[model samples]
Target chain A: EAGVTQSPTHLIKTRGQQATLRCSPISGHTSVYWYQQALGLGLQFLLWYDEGEERNRGNFPPRFSGRQFPNYSSELNVNALELEDSALYLCASSLYRTKVAETQYFGPGTRLLVL
Target chain B: GIQVEQSPPDLILQEGANSTLRCNFSDSVNNLQWFHQNPWGQLINLFYIPSGTKQNGRLSATTVATERYSLLYISSSQTTDSGVYFCAVEQDFGNEKLTFGTGTRLTIIP
Candidate 1:
């Protein structure tokens, strides 16, 4: 089976601009998760969507928002971006919400560079 | 919020050697996962072992949920294993959000 896939491998935007990243989960997966890996900040959870509902979110600001489609694909939107927003945005997917122990496969991630 | 701490923030080993990385959580967790961030910055899931033990190729992970800790072992480490290894846990009482540790940076010399 194909793994999680992300679009626009690299993006360059300026502060105050908006950026949108896309993710297509595995064919049979139902849970989509977004994470941000900023340099020196480590990997931080951004959002988690299961069955088309926003189940949980990280401590990030409202500017960092995303949604999952019926097909289980997800999109993360960053509005009024700041330089600190520059990082590798990753998307992961699992079979379903059966349990939290299920493995979450990840994508190559989209590197967003805000100037 | 749960606190996750990884030991030996950085390690360097020669190729063909073995290594062990540790992760400790402040609270009990229902989910524990190990990931390898490659040089290209891709987060590759190594294991989702909430309890018991699991192994894949040269990598093996064991999580003692009751003890609130997990361990990752790499046998015969290779140059490809040079990267940052992170342990993420989801607290049983939380919203299922993963709390990630600072990670252990591993470097393997040829």
Candidate 2:
């Protein structure tokens, strides 16, 4: 089975521009999550979507948003990007359950650079 | 929010040496995972051991959920093992979102 896949391995944008990153979950997976790994800062959860609905969000600003499709693929949108927004955006997926925790597999991550 | 911490922020070992990495969480977790981040920044899943122990090839991980800690053992480490290892956890049961640790950078010198 294929693991999680991401698009645009690298991206370069200027401040105030918008950036969109995409991720496709592994086969048979139903939950998608986004995380940002900033320089000097560890990975931070961005968003969580399951069954086509947003489930949870981190402490990021409103500019960081994303949605999951019916096929369990997800897209993360960063609007009005800032220099600090430059980071490796990773997406992970896992089987969705209400009570049982499932293992999450990650993608290669999109390296976004905001100038 | 749960905080995850990794010990020995960095380690350097000669090829064929053995190493142990540790992870500690501030609260109970329903999910615990170990990932190896390659130099190119791709996170490769190493283990999904929330409890008990599991081994794959030269790597083995044990998670003691009750103690809120986990240990990853890399036996006879190779130069290929050089990279950053991260431990992530899901604090709330069924909440798939992961909170990652600061990561442990391991360098294996040939």
In every candidate, what fraction of the native interface contacts is reproduced?
A: 0.66, 0.85
Off by over 4 Å in 2: none
Tens digits of lDDT, candidate 2, A48-97 = 99999999899899999988888889999999999999999999988988
Residue A46 shift from truth in candidate 1, angstroms: 0.9
Off by over 4 Å in 1: A98-100
Per-residue lDDT of model 1, residues A4-114, tens digit only: 999999999999999999999999988899999999898899999989999899889999998999888999999999999999999988865544356778899999999
Q: What is the C-alpha RMSD of each candidate to the true structure, in Å?
A: 1.5, 0.9
In model 2 chain B, which range of ten residues has the least summed lDDT?
B89-98
Q: What residue pairs clash in candidate 2, if any at all?
A: none
lDDT of predicted model 1: 0.90
lDDT of 1 by residue, B12-88 (tens): 99999999999999987888889999988888889989899999999999988888899999999999999999999
| Real contacts retained, model 1 | 0.66
The candidate maximizing lDDT is: 2
CA lDDT, candidate 2, residue B18: 97
